[model samples]
Target: MKLSHIKLYPLAIPLIEPIKMSGETITHANTLLVYLKTNTGKEAWGETSAAPLMTGETLGGLLQNAKYLGEHLRGLDITELNSISMVLGKILYGNTSVKSCFEMAIIDLFAQAQDTSVWQILRDLSKNKTQTKPIPLPLLRMLGGSLDKEVADAALYRAQGYRHWKIKVGSLPLAEDLERVSILCDLLAGDIVSADANGAFNLDQAVIFCTAEKTRQLSFVEQAIAAKSTIDDFSLLKSKSHLPIALDESIHDVNEIKYFDQANALDGASLKLIKTGGLVSGLAAALELQRRNLKINLACKVAETSLSAAATASLGFAIDSIPWGFSMSNQYLEFDICAKPLHAENGHLNIEQLNPIGIGVTPEINLVTQAHSKEYSTVLC
Candidate 1:
């Protein structure tokens, strides 16, 4: 089948609660959705969120690039995903978030054409080359607000069976951060705790922070130093610290993996489809990290709809090495845009919901119809 039509939907859904991280707060889902239609009447959906601070991608840029990509995609054979990906790489350099939207759309369409899930597609392509099975995904919830508020939230999540927690530091003084973490750990004994600085600390501060009394109690430390911090700095911190150091924003490509491997710098790496440009590339990076014995964390964009959540869950189901847990932000959305929403039960996401065709969940027709004013569609010549 050949490419026949393309539609773009720009959605800005309000979050149920504002997400506080990296010294900022996010209150809405700034994502652009794409619907790809083939000549044979097969169609699939894809989405991308704007993270200007992380990936240097904006909603405006993603929308423009997606429209431009649609122009180039006209009449192209739908089955040649590699060809499409290669051409996409040539179409723009460093607009990875934008590139991810088209990549997801093509892969979603391809999987739909095959009457299979995207997880199955990646499982077959994995290095193991074996049929993959769905597995339970343990989730990590972020801790925010005042110390008392954080404890309250943690208590609620703990009751929900969430055992892993991530507390953001670097925004507060080291001593206060330590005190908060210590209290939380005392409140929830035996559960895993991680500290994410969101690249807020300097090299010296990172080392000092990790070596502190309560900081050492964490399961791991994420991006203690800034994203632009050198491998040398990370190596130095890793050498001095007892806890494993994970790089989130620091990881952008597979080549960075080699850098970390050569220096023995990081103990973990976080993977997100939007950051890696899509599931195909994200999985490749994840497998390589696994081969190197580094911990992997599957994360979803903040305020993403169920469509992206379903895609993330599908990937989580196939990959068993992601022991660091997933950062699923579906709970932050006020009203999801999918017909069937993805929810976590007792910290474990149900695998059955991720078994649908293509990327799993379908967009709610009523919501899509209501958002038509935000949509731009064209029939490719």
Candidate 2:
């Protein structure tokens, strides 16, 4: 069936509690949700969340791009996802977040049309070895603002059955960062705690923090230095620190993977679908990383709704290769605008089952209506 209509909803959902990262405090999540309707009357959902600081795409820009994408998508065959992705990629240079949003919606719709989950679709597409058992999904915990807050946050997540936590670092003074790490270790005991620097640190600073005698409990350090830092610098940092490093911004595409390989820059990499464009590219990156025997951390954007979450869940199941971010399941802490809450049990999220002919869930009509009304009045989209 061909796509008949598409709609975009730009939303700002306030967080119940503020989430503080290195350079900013996030009190509300700003995101765009995309809806696609087929000629056969099937509907699918998708989400794209852009942090102006991260991707440099504002809400207005995202919405405009969504409109442009929607126009191109209209009249396209729903099942030809790869062709659609290629055509869109040729038109849009680096707005993978926008492209991914549309691609995901189409995939969701395709799966629903078949009355199956995205995982089943992916399993059928795989040429590699497939495991028979379901992989256990991991809980994602964020590192809080201060040393005391980090400890408290870890304890809070642990109480809720989370054993893995990711702490934010790099923005703090070296001494202060170590102090927080110490506190986190004490609170978490034997639990896993990874540190995300968010590309805030320099190579020397990252080396010092990773090698510091007081910081020994870290599972890995993520994007400790800016993406511009040379792979050689990462190699030097890796040599000096006991902790392994995971590349985030550093490995954006296949070419970058070769660069990292040549430089021996990291022990692992974090793959986000938006960064790589969609599930297809993200999976390709993961498989390549696996071929190199490097660890992988599958991550999601903060503003993702259930549509993107379902696709991410499929990735988690298909890989089962590593523990990664799946924090949307705990939206009570993060703030979610989706009508239905994502379900999590014992720190694990069961994959959302997509209806065989379209995206399983529909957009929250009231929220979308209100957003569109505001856009009409404000000329936002």
TM-score of each: 0.94, 0.90
| Per-candidate clash tally | 0, 10
Residue 113 miss distance in model 1 (angstroms)? 1.6
How does candidate 2 score on lDDT? 0.71
Q: How many angstroms is residue 311 displaced in model 1 relative to the true structure, after the best TM-score fit?
A: 1.4
In model 1, the runs with Cα more than 4 Å from the true position are 129-132, 369-381
RMSDs, each prediction?
A: 2.3, 2.7
lDDT of 2 at 259: 76
lDDT by residue for model 1 (1-381), tens: 677888778777778778788667888788888887889888878888888778877777778887887787777775565665577787676777777777887888888878888878777667455554667788888888888899999999999999888888877877787798788878877777888888998887888878887765688899888878777888899999988988888887688877987898899888887888887778778888988889888888786778888777667776755688888877777888776688878887877867568888778767755533234332232
TM-score of 1: 0.94
Instruction: Tell how far residue 241 is off in model 2, in angstroms.
Output: 1.8
